[model samples]
Target: MLRWLIGGGREPQGLAEKSALQSIGEDQTQNPYTELLVLKAHHDIVRFLVQLDDFRFASAGDDGLVVVWNAQTGAKLLELSGHTQKITAIVPFPPMESSKENSQLILTASADRTVIVWDYDTGRQVQRSCFQSTVKCLTVLQRLDIWLSGGNDLGVWNRKLDLLCKTSHLSDTGISALVETPRNCVVAAVGKELIIFRVVAPTETLPRWDIVEVKRLLDHQDNILSLINVNDLNFVTGSHVGELIIWDILDWSVQAYELNFWNPSAQLDAQQEIKLCQKLNDISINHFTCDEENIFAAVGRGLYVYNLQMKRVIACQKMAHDSNVLHIAKLPNRQLISCSEDGSVCIWELREKRQLPAEPVPTGFFNMWGFGRVNKQASQPMKKQQEDTTPCFLEPVGDLIGHSSSVEMFLYFEDHGLVTCSADHLIILWKNGEQESGLRSLKLFQKLEENGDLYRAV
Candidate 1:
């Protein structure tokens, strides 16, 4: 019975050959997610999923609603409704040490130009504040016990929702992303520029907290799309034209850079495909995720793994998906998961490629053109070039095909499995089939023994 539940039963005569081909062609031995539970709550698209605790997570999106769920049992715990428009950003706001009770809190920003703090345990809105413009992003500074909001301008607030300091209107286009750095500094991506700001805490001479712009980085040629702090010493940013720049956190200088150009002519010989015109979105860098050593990037419909120490691409899959990938994440055991506009989520593993003794080891791809320290005043743009064959490869292990429209993002809970939210207005909780089967059998045996059925059968 348990084997049948996991699709282990024999197939019909006509379908046997087809099933055998699938099982042999696709290697699913390393993939553990064979069971899933579909969860539906939102009427519109579900865009964001944030983990609130070990066994719980909250999801919010275009429906202008926030729903909390139990990761272990696939149960709906709470439904939070306050925003009049769609939600743009959501983050967990952990409790301080001095608080009376250890209630979990969350912060959500919406297109209605309001930010609300909710206590999800009681399904109550603890605090709410309206802004002059819609807040597109939110980042919490846990060390300073304050949060920052980004939109047309930058604003800082305390846990009590009191405005502490704010910057003057920085850009009409609004800030796209925000990330905190060491020494009380923050980086904001506005249009094509990256602005560095310093936050000054109140002191004896200063009566109020202040935010001052330190520098403006104009390295990117196109609009910045993604920004992330890789570690304490460096941060990375991706642009609309597929240019990836790694910046030093201390001085805000470019450490390494690369332009991921997708040349149509290169694919003509191998695939016999000809593309007359290429759009800006074709090679756009949509998102990035990183581990301790490498940065995984979702560029167009492909995946690229770049090493920070080597400062070069180690491995890449030019066409990992049928459509543009929206989000990617690094999982344990050298595994990676990515979701795309094609409405599919895939699992991949990084494996070292075996080489023959006669073949010489390839050098770094960027060796011809030195890219160590970039000249800020250089007039010429970096030329588009193909990457050399790498020593590693990404092997696809499993596919989760369920969403009909698009899979926006996903969350990986180490023990609770994977939770994915999609543009189809549905969420899926993928569980390990083998682990769940064992748990079910153990429970059944325990119940039978308690009811004396085990002794009677013996």
Candidate 2:
């Protein structure tokens, strides 16, 4: 089953001879990852992977070293070393037109309370600055040609590394995450609160740039773990508890709130089996990614698809992985990719399920959102509430098993393939088997023609 799911050297077989599981695994839109290349560079667990350009990406982690790799070929290009401690955050600095050449640059923050900007092409440290506290997160405001660093306080800087403005200390716990919103506003997740700040550039009357704290949101019940901008109109934040909130970007008001993740009656399996209980930590929203229509959430070991228009969970897998899911990414064509602490990466498709004419119409919120309905039996309430109300279900398509430890996160490079970093101290470049085979055949034919052997081969 594993071999067939990952397309492990198996030739295509007839549909008539395939099992139901094999038929789903062989769907045309299933995961195309078959060939893989394991890249080794960091000695410690790899935690972060950031793309630098179309064909290059960088990986950093507890090893205190950042290694750049060619995503297309999985070849190590440069090893950037300067940080004396584990890297906490990394973001790319867009190339400036004023430079002698449009050289790609990257900014990295470390536990050593310092941030360094490096020119990836030359492997040279361009600028370095010491911070009062370790920068936990970094956000680039490309429109303004500046960046912001969040830690004990929020600091804004320009391309030359000059501190333009900063805020007073707000929290000892420091800012866990930061995201840019429209209209020159920034949102910082500090402990259990969300602080909104507006960046004001110098004008004819102002004469100086400033960052002003606009509002404070005190809705989350626990520490905020994940925060991201969904679109120009709204942004979303997930808490250490099972709370997920969507906030209006302009007014900083709660647009939507969901706490149903902890409701035991909502946990339903494919066979309509009810999961009675879940630990508190298991329901924490670890990460979030989205497309235009839905928000994909990595909640504990499960993967959920929440529709923005409907404001409800349209599809979900209560136990998508064997362990806690660390990160998730939305792929094209209604597909999702999630990595877990169990040392595995799984691909899922949000396929629509046909509704039966005999099925009763759902009425309650739980049933309406596909959380299942209570059965007629009185004693088995847990087992009763195991039905679906939505029209979609997450189908397991492919499983990429190579890492020996936790798979931290991954970056999808389209034609270049998928790049995943792991706690096993390895980076695996997963490629489309069929596309790679065609590329190899094309290269061979080109070589044969160059050597004047094409006619003999034909």
Candidate 3:
């Protein structure tokens, strides 16, 4: 729920398209984009963290307090508290500029099967909804003016905080995750299949939940753990079997696959012949990240970056983090930020300075370089003006403090504060502190864009 309210003006339609790769191999140049702040915890666990735009940031833990911090100063501003159980997810809704709303709203889902909407200005819950089933995943679609929530069931809620539409009918799938598109359609990974649903509030029919099965590619060697819509057409699906499959949403077919584990069947399952048993034994994909430039997926051991478009593995570092990564977020500026069960948060430079096979996120391949800007063609691959590699991971500029537990998830709100939630039962917010020296390296190409070292001379 990042707000484009950066002084709210004109937003370029979207990025152009790019090529979709099958796998990332070695020799591919790869790096991280933004500097990461590994917030240190002092108590139970630092469950999660998030940014609230440019104003504030929040982080939560089992400690109960949702610490709000200054985005630029990293000063603790306030605390958001109220949940009795573990907080699972946190999202910030940047009020529409036209609405003239002063403060923003923070929405949190907890293991208590409850969703709390907070008015950060006062650090209190303005409203809340209780569910009998645990809330597994959540995504807010402003385009459709609705919020989609999934747990034991998939449902939709309106801006008025009303349960406008819901159906326990999909209970069979036991929805786990959700992703929304520009058109406002909601795609959910529920049951044994990937279910696509749209929100429709007809003047005649009671708001309805339309379930469209995109692909029944079932018999998952294990549970369909997570479904991420990288962009509009290309989505990535992760399974308990450690096999992550990237699918072409438009065609409802598997475009490529990442095999971290063994799959019982080959259909749509990303399988590879890895002679090394250690690589596949417990290589869990806890997170999937894409710079819309290159692709990186987190395994049980470390992070694996590849140019799926070129089918080359750019970089694979073992023991980058202590445990399996819990989640990964690609920043708006094309940086990769991630949090893991290892109780650490890391930011990496994503732009490779040299040419590398482009393997953007599983789905955003079409929209990464602004491909879907015009809806050119389905089979079209994206090509950039330069084959030059851009430095990926810049460097960690700052560190966040407060959470006392394992940081499960963290996402930047772009020029705003960061929002994170953890199993510790609270959501922590991190305000973007001062730009560290690392940002200087970011201008490497831009300064050198015009002439080789001549731009620096002039």
Candidate 4:
């Protein structure tokens, strides 16, 4: 003020510059992923989780048991046991529009090389069929009454497990992921490249179904770890190289946007910048889920939010999980649910951001020797400033903790709470909106493990 008054009034320019600098000094903080309830889900490693309906979800484990749970109350609804080996995939059959049947069917593929169809409500196996090789993944095409299974080879089958077409011509490498598009196209991730196929009509020469590879997407430099179809024309993929690629089904020529976990800035110190670069190189996107305009990514142990249209990370929560975050799901209320190899499921809510008052610089503009006048000037507002500038961090609003070993995967729905499967070979159903103090559910699990004949010698 004294300088402005003495030097022909430069207050406006000086204040504007100060305001700009202050804004630049503000640091944005993200919310931590919290836990709600932990259900001891499986007796063996939970390999797959699937939502059966708005109120129910099912989990498959290495113990060869498929259990269904009520999401709202964390109650076990039914246990479907049949598979002899690890369950690799589980998917709910799409409802038939023309039929009036009330019961829903679930298809489970296993390392035993068989696909079993079960009446989820009755807990009975309705049908079963063996594949030529161990089935690693399954995608149901309900409109045509056919489903695709991938393992040592890829095969198309009817609802009755009658093999329609089987082919190994697509790749010498095994398929890792499978997704079907609205345009009747199937995208198969074979090692590093994606093979797009369309079913050919059956004829006399081939009395069964046939598929022809339409296009091969080879944009990724490393193995494609996960694939998801955003819409009929758009899809997203995460690679082993920590790259997220978005592609258009209609036009492969449209360049894919490769996004990374972190973007460093010029102001960061050399050591800090190098550490960030190394972190991104070490991290790989493990799973992803989308809600409206944003995509939630589980990159290593962190959670990142990317704007779909802008193609950039808007927010991130580092070290969301102590171990690799294997799966992430977005809740209806805009919170996120994540499961990790750390054996926990967490819930995170993004709070509204507010501009906090900036802190006083430790050193003065004009310092005497190496010391400054900050200590003398900071006395009045030090406590307030310290409280305001206490780096905002996301803390999990609720925590679920019962899994004994690595939590392999989970499925969640707004109407249903959460169902997680683990290496412990138990499946837990977490109820939505219910609050209990300090993992009371663990006792329930202990009692069940002791009394239930499922784990004891017959």
Candidate 5:
């Protein structure tokens, strides 16, 4: 009778274990990363987001739904359904004026090991191409009408979905990131190594493209995360160990300045700070982007900005998110936008601090009032103007929160606003504090929980 009342031992092992874990409050806590309004987007966790243009964006999730949104009004424009598994990537194909048939298209990859090209405006799948393994990342060569898909191997294909070449010679460990070179070569990062492949093509070959290994640069001790093009001949890479390195494309040599796990900055001191650096080294770099002056790297839970001219880290904000920052994008207005595994989106702006006057102001008058001004001198407007113009630090300008689970990715649209996707199965459209409606909706669940009616409501 006791064994029967306890449900016996006949229950599946996995089910019993899951029930015990739930009873111990494994997944019951409320998500702490809420800022603005929330939108219920997907039936499962959102996985990727991409900006279609200045006004529209798309998000794909585990529910196999690709949702398009009007960036300005936060309205759902359309929902595309086709993939049978979790979506891996969503990339926007820039419009080609040369190809009249090519309007705007979106290319999406899924865990089903298939890449689907969709006419994003019409919400119709145009073509589908299968791969041998999961497509981890993708890059497009717009001028050449070619695209590279990276996974266990690298596959080069044309706009018509014809596979030009497939090669595993670059890296057996798998391609982590890909970039193009000025000399028509391809740079592939695999683990801690950077492999440069020179491309060759024959006018009448069955496989139209071929890649030959030219050079392999091995400077990092950890897995490389993201690669950024500083200029035509200069590039930068961030690693899983919080290391940043700049590479000269001409000679593929490392630059003088380096940000690594060993406290690359001479200003870093103290045992506690050193220990903190050690902990940071264990964290990973998730995304990277830059404008003309600064390189922004989202590493672990922090957002780090490095000054290119100064060749040093000028600002590092720890806990930019409660968890890992997954993606980052720089807006047209010089604002930094980032999303994280903590289910939060934050916007950052840079501004310079006013420089203190070199000469002291007159203090005699202030002494009489117990708040004396310093001695005054001639104005130095030129120096002050220069000082005021230089960007001193990155400051948080705004935050948009809505997701109940980890935010996978976010994209910024200039004509519209921001679009973010989360693991909570949500996609939120945010503007500049126009409407704050999620506050009431997010609280309704909490009220139910407090009243002990949450289970019944669910």
Candidate 6:
């Protein structure tokens, strides 16, 4: 890899070191390789895995047991045992500030139709909460001392794991995933919809939940895969229809949309087949991430870069890894990191570019015109894609991959490596990127940050 970069006159940065890894825990699930990029023969498959926002790792498996590993060392810090059926999902809680010591705690969901809060450091069960149906997805809001869990039904609980509110069968289909936002933790279910509810402290009231309905979204035509909140007022979501929808949290209408290309195959199809991609229902939005400049989204076959303010598709690259995309996230320095079901983790540099005009007429002035213009946003569109054949910018500049299997989730450590979890039942520590890119996204964002257009546009 280094040789290829050097030959191209691109010096490798310190973060570009080829990855070498060691597995910490063995996966014990059956026929795990039935999945992509995962090495089943070498490890056991834990069904539900999470690298908590705070960097703690938790996973529950077929054994009806849950194990918590320190996100970096992959060391078995604690083991939770109780469920009689397969455990489906697990989430960790941040340490309470008032506690004298940092105690490790997590919420685990199971097929046995119950949810349990375990003290990972001591392997003690803080609370064992149950439901009528199997548990599928779980989310924790430590600051609010509340957690959300759902399966056939959706329920909210206090930090102690007591049922606070129940949206009995929010959808006919089972819940898929849950995420906490400023107002609530939005839950996506098997049906093409989402239920957003405010986190309420346990209290006696009319709704009694203190939790209120934010909205009920039925934007997708089929089952929704994942929901990523870009900000307090906006979110990006993917569905089984291969449609990626970006919406304002406060409004119900769709703001921007793109098709998840490459679901058909890897070979780039130049035959301009104008298909209606307004909705994407490919492999289900497996993972999603967005920085201040770009929204990085992936469903099995897609890697989409949607400009936040521009509201346009910038780069839609297809990575054929023979499996679904497990996770997509942003590094501290803002590079995009992605992992797939095929057992591969990739670091992506958000390359920015401007369209060159059809006529190569060079403008000799310093004024705003042509590619030489200060803002591509202000420049006229090229006559078409083919006539403007030259690449305005091209270079690889970020390095942020560090996983041996399908990295499911990650936690960032400033100035140090990040913590990640993989299907191989191993957690990894990765250094952030050090290389620089010649990509246009780099300088474009730089300009935006420098108030490059504020003085003139404003």
Q: Considering every candidate listed, which one attains the maximal TM-score?
A: 2
User: CA lDDT, every prediction?
Assistant: 0.84, 0.83, 0.57, 0.67, 0.69, 0.57
Error of 2 at 209 (Å): 2.1
Instruction: Quote each prediction's TM-score.
Output: 0.85, 0.87, 0.63, 0.72, 0.73, 0.66
For candidate 2, what is the lDDT?
0.83
**Please, what are the lDDT tens digits per residue for candidate 1 over residues 304-367?**
8999989877888889999999999999999999999998889999988887666343346553
Model 1: colliding residue pairs: none
Cand. 1 TM to true fold: 0.85
Worst 10 residues of 5 by lDDT: 17-26
Q: What lDDT score is found at residue 297 in candidate 6?
A: 72
lDDT of 2 by residue, 35-111 (tens): 76667778788999999989999999998899999988877899999999999999999855565658688999999
Estimate candidate 2's RMSD in Å: 8.4
Residues forming the 10-long window of minimal summed lDDT in candidate 6: 30-39
In model 6, which regions exceed 4 Å deviation?
A: 1-43, 47-56, 59-63, 71-74, 95-103, 181-190, 198-207, 210-215, 260-283, 320-322, 354-458
Model 6 Cα lDDT, one tens digit per residue, 1-458: 11111122312222222223322222322111111111121134445556544555566566676766554334566666798887788777767676665666777777788888877768889888768888788776767666777687667777666677776555546878776665544545456877766655644555466556667877677677777778766777776756678776665468887552433332333222224344333445676788776777786655666677776555655553446667777754445666666555555555446764565534566544445644564465534332233222212332223343455555555433455455555444543223112333687777876986745665
lDDT tens digits by residue: candidate 3, 1-458: 12212122212122111111111112212222222222323234556566665666677655545667665444566767777776777777766656665667878888777888788878767888998787767777765556777887777776557786675656744677777643445567665466666566554565454534333455345556666666655877776556677777665577776663332223342433333334442566666767554567776746666565664345554455666777776665445666766556665544445555855444467666667634554556643211112233233322333333566776566554466655544444444323433345566656777557756577
- Cα deviation in Å at residue 382, candidate 5? 33
Q: How big is the positional error of residue 414 in model 5, measured in Å on the Cα after superposition?
A: 1.5
Q: State which candidate, 1 or 2, has the greater lDDT.
A: 1
